[model samples]
Target: MAEILNLVGSKIRDYRKAKGLSQDQLAELCGFHFSYIGGVERGERNISLENLAKIAETLKVEPKVFFDFNHSFVQPPSDKKEAALQEVLTLLQAKELRHIQMTKKLLMEIFKTFPRQ
Candidate 1:
């Protein structure tokens, strides 16, 4: 049950970031408290189905996206590199245009440690 909560929380966080919404913004859209939204993202809250539906709608993703467990890429990252990369992606997706240069610099630093594909 805890694992499920964590997975659901991660999916919610990913979709929320992808849509460029802060927890406060998402909470506003779902008529929930910002702290509740933060708890949901942290896997500390067991969301009711009604609230889940509201979240799905607010994130512009189907509820099923949260339960799709086949992709290891979407699962909790198993290593530090994957975790760091995921965080970078989330930030890049969520932040405004003014952050692009900083994001690019971060990306360049990360990629410097790897060979070009």
Candidate 2:
């Protein structure tokens, strides 16, 4: 139970950072106090489902995403190509949805124009 809380807290922190939002900013958006946000992130609070939903909505992610611990352990890239892919993923991780969609479209067009052998 404590471990689950910690995991959820860590996931929330990761998403919050990825979205480039500070604790205060996220708290403001979710109508929570900054201290509450900090507590949640630190696993010091047993967050309620209602509060969790609010945070999830504010973060623009589904609440279930926070519980997806199975894929949380990312292996380090083993090769140059994999490293490059990881770099690209990291770059896109912080982008807005529309920006990511635009990037995907651009990449698709470029690929169509230059087919791989």
Candidate 3:
């Protein structure tokens, strides 16, 4: 049960960050206190399903997305580049289609600015 709480909390944190929202901002949108948001993200609170649904609605994600923990079992990255890539992929998870497309375009533009090796 604790593991499930932690997994759900971690997923909520990931989705929250992906939406470019601060804890204060998300809490405000969900009509919750910032400390409550922190507690939820830290797995210190066992969130109610109704509250969880409110959070999901605020984050523009489906509630079930938080429980899709299969990807959380990934092995540690072997190098810095791999670690960074993994972080990027994690941030991309559960993001809206338009936002993902915007991110891809931004990445492409940023990469073009890099000098040839």
Candidate 4:
């Protein structure tokens, strides 16, 4: 599906950026054109398995890594603020899950002090 392709492309872009490789550089490493790499990163190309394998090998990651989509990353925000909020929520979910219930209770009590909208 297009959505999965987009997700995979986005992850590839993220990893590529994190590894400090330019599209042209990645393309050279994978024996492809810079334009092709660009298209892949932008989700415009439905990458073939052979090419994907080459890319994975060039990137020093497993082929399966490209398809390892996490539920939290299923969708991305178009807005910067929403993206930041999502990242904060992800961190909180990972680090403060047990404290969430207490936080929710405190928020509910605080809300009671305010007039209904």
Which candidate comes out best when scored by TM-score? Answer: 2
Q: Which stretches of candidate 2 lie over 4 Å from their true place?
A: 73-117
Rank ordering of all candidates by lDDT, starting from the highest: 2, 3, 1, 4
Residue 59 lDDT in candidate 2: 79
lDDT of 3 by residue, 16-65 (tens): 88778899999999999878999998889999999999999998777998
Candidate 1: segments with Cα more than 4 A from true spot: 72-117
TM-score of every prediction relative to native: 0.61, 0.63, 0.61, 0.60
- Sliding window of 10 residues with minimal summed lDDT for model 4: 69-78
lDDT (tens digit, per residue) of candidate 1 on 1-117: 889988989889988877779999999999998799899888999999999999999877789888876543244455899999887776676677879887788879999999889
Error of 3 at 117 (Å): 25
Taking every candidate in turn, the Cα RMSD to the unseen true structure, in Å, is 12.7, 11.0, 11.1, 8.8
Lowest summed lDDT across 10 adjacent residues in model 3 is found at: 69-78
Show pairs that collide, candidate 1: none
Q: How close is candidate 3 to the true structure, as a TM-score?
A: 0.61
Which residue pairs of candidate 4 clash? none
Tens digits of per-residue lDDT for model 2, 1-117: 889889999999988887889999999999988799999988999999999999999978889988988656334456899989988987887799999999999999999989589
Off by over 4 Å in 4: 71-117
Q: What lDDT score goes with residue 60 in model 1?
A: 71
